[model samples]
Target: MSLWALAWTLVFVATAMGLSMWRRLGLEKDMLIAAVRATVQLMAIGYVLKFVFRVDHAALTSAMVLLMSAVAADNASRRGQRLAGRFWRVWMAVMSTEIVTLGFLLASRVIPFQPAYVIPISGMIIGNAMVASALFLNRLRGEAQARRDEMMVLLTLGATPRQASRHVVKAAVKASMIPTIDSTKTMGLVQLPGMMTGQIIAGADPIQAVRYQLLIVFALIASAAFTTMVLGALTYGRLFNEYLQPVV
Candidate 1:
């Protein structure tokens, strides 16, 4: 479709969905505000990305990647109710995961340093980390909050913070990991995800697209696992205190 067609398509669909959501939920103001925010935010990011991609400097590109990761992590933490320290810790974990994975991928030549490789892969991993962290932290914090008495009981019994919330933490991390796991398992069978579908639509061979899909799956697993664990661990640490106690 042409640019104008795509613009109209997006506007109409967004408007229709916003109106429907408002009517159904009786949240006209919130729905309309969110729709406006979505439109403005996407457009702003589009222009900013255009500028960033135009600059061929590695530092500039890396900075942009970091910026995106930070924003995503922040959103994840904000969407979920996490303590400030714990929230920052989750952000740190996500940042570390992105830096390490993107670093290794670039260093080892898995994904080259070009905008094409660097930008897209960073986006995928960051997006995954964002979702995984959001799921993990939200559930982890909520469960830990609910089980505050249990955590205190464990801590009073001489368990460290990590030790105190170990079971709950483990469950939350696993819960967050479930989405990625299910999606991976059902990739080609139940669904052709955006990446695979996009590749085929771009005229790539189906077999090759599947191969690429496998790589993405593996990459996602690695990013999600590392990020979820690190972020969960970090959040766990801050959600507790010096005397092997839980802040929650």
Candidate 2:
């Protein structure tokens, strides 16, 4: 698409701002800021990706993927700010997910180890894992607060912290994973994923696009599950103090 064509797409943003104003929702500023930031960020990434794809160096590609994973973990860790070592917990979960999913694809010879393929696929995996991590952390915080009494009772009954927080951790993990599971269930019928849609729009064959989309679908589900589970395991222990009483 041309610059003019891309500029015309701002109509949707204008429409959103207009609706916010009409409803007196007080979201016009936030909407406008988001729109501006999204435009600028996408343009910046587009250029960076162009350069990376041209260079196609292994070290640079690996650095780019690591940077993306780090950023994602940092963002997700905010949800667990009250927990100690939240950043590292999130980073480990995200990195593990990236390593496992991407490793499998590369080992199976499904996609080349080039920046053009790895970077984009890694972005999606990291993004999904980030969301899953954030969701799990947020839900775990809420569960800990809401179930403080129950956990305390369990603790008083001589249960370990892990056992006492088992229900809460399980609930949080399930809650975090539900969105990915539901989206996968309704995938093609409900919506064409962005990657698949973009590929088709770029004149790729529909079958090839679908194949790539399926690969992404599987990777995303695995990413969500692994990240949430790992994050839950790492985080649940922090809920208790040295005396084994509930702290979180």
Candidate 3:
């Protein structure tokens, strides 16, 4: 689409603002901010990606991936305000998830080690990991707070910190992963994924688009699961102190 066509998309944002005003939802300010922020961020990324694609250097590609991971970690860490060492915990989770998934894809030759493919795929993986980590942290904190008495009872019954918090951790991980798993299950039937839709729009074969989308879907599931599990394990320990008492 041309700039003119893209400019027309603001009508949707205007509609959202109008609705917010009509219903007295008090979201007009947020809606305007989000729209402007999205536009600026996307335009900036587009330019940055253009430069990266032109350079096509492995070092530059790796740096871009690291930058994305760091930013994602920062964003996810905000959701864990009550958790100790939130930034490092989320940074470790996102970095580990990206390394494992990207390493396997490169080593297996499933995707070539090029900026064009690596940057976009890594962005998707890192983004999904960020969301998963945030969800896990939020759910775990809520569950721990809601079930504090149950955890205390287990602690009084000679349960170790890990054992007492096991149920909450499991539930949080499962809750965090459900969205990714469910989305994958409904890919073709309910919705055409963005990757596949983009490929098709760019004139790629439909079948080939499906294959690439499938790879992404699978990668997202693995990334989400790994991130949630890692974050849950690292975080649950923080909820208890040396005396096996609930600190959160």
Candidate 4:
């Protein structure tokens, strides 16, 4: 669409803010901030991506991907600020997820090893991994806090930290993965995914768009599961002291 067309889209944002005001939902400030922030971020990234796509250097592309992963990990780590080494755990989980997912895609020749293909897909995978890690960490921390008494009893019975917190770890991992799993199951019936819809709007064949969307859907499932599982395993031990007793 043209800039004029894009400008018209602000009407929707205005309507949202209007509704927030009318309902006294107390979200007007947040909605306004988000709208402005999204616009600025997207425009900046649009220029950056345009330049990167033009350059198309392998090292540059890889650096861009790393920057994205680092940003994602940092954002995810915010959800568990009190968890020791949370940022590194999130960074490791997200980076590993990106490597595994992209490795398969490149090795299988499902997508070409170029900025056009790698950058967008990496963004999606990294973002999903970030959400998964954040959810797992947040839930893990919550579960550990809530079940400290139970875990203390298990500790007293000679259970190790992992054994004492096994249930909490499992629950947190499962919680983190539930959204991705549910979205995959309900993809077409519940909502048309953004990638597929964008492709079709850009005049790509619907079938081809569907195929790419399927690849994304499958990758997201793996990304979310792997990120949550890895992060949960790495982080659950933090809930306990060196003496194997639950910590506050």
- Which candidate has the highest lDDT of all? 2
Candidate 1 vs candidate 3, TM-score winner: 3
Ordered from best to worst lDDT, the candidate numbers read 2, 3, 4, 1
Tens-place lDDT digits, model 3, residues 1-248: 89999999999999999999999999999999999999999999999999999999999999999899999989999986888898889989998999999899999999999999999999999999999998998899888988899999999999988889998999999999999999988889999999899999999999999998889998999999999888887788999888888988
> RMSD (Cα, Å) of candidate 2?
1.7
lDDT of each: 0.79, 0.95, 0.92, 0.92
Candidate 3 or 1, higher lDDT: 3
Q: Name the runs in model 1 displaced over 4 angstroms.
A: 7-47, 79-82, 243-245
**Better structure of 2 and 3 per TM-score:** 2
Q: What is the lDDT of residue 193 in candidate 1?
A: 77
**TM-score for every candidate vs. truth?**
0.82, 0.93, 0.92, 0.94
Candidate 2: TM-score? 0.93
Cα error of candidate 4 at position 75, Å: 1.1
lDDT of 3: 0.92
**Measured by TM-score, how close is model 1 to the native structure?**
0.82
How would you order the candidates by TM-score, starting with the best? 4, 2, 3, 1
Q: Per-residue CA lDDT of candidate 1, range 1-248, in tens? A: 46787677667656766787867966666656886799799789878778777876788888878787878877888745547665577678788888888788778777678776677778888899899988887788788878889888887788877788888888888989999999998888898978879889899999988886787788788888898889766777767756566666
Error in Å for residue 157 of model 2? 3.5
lDDT score, candidate 2: 0.95
| RMSD (Å) per prediction | 3.2, 1.7, 1.9, 1.7
Q: In candidate 4, how many Å is residue 6 off?
A: 1.3
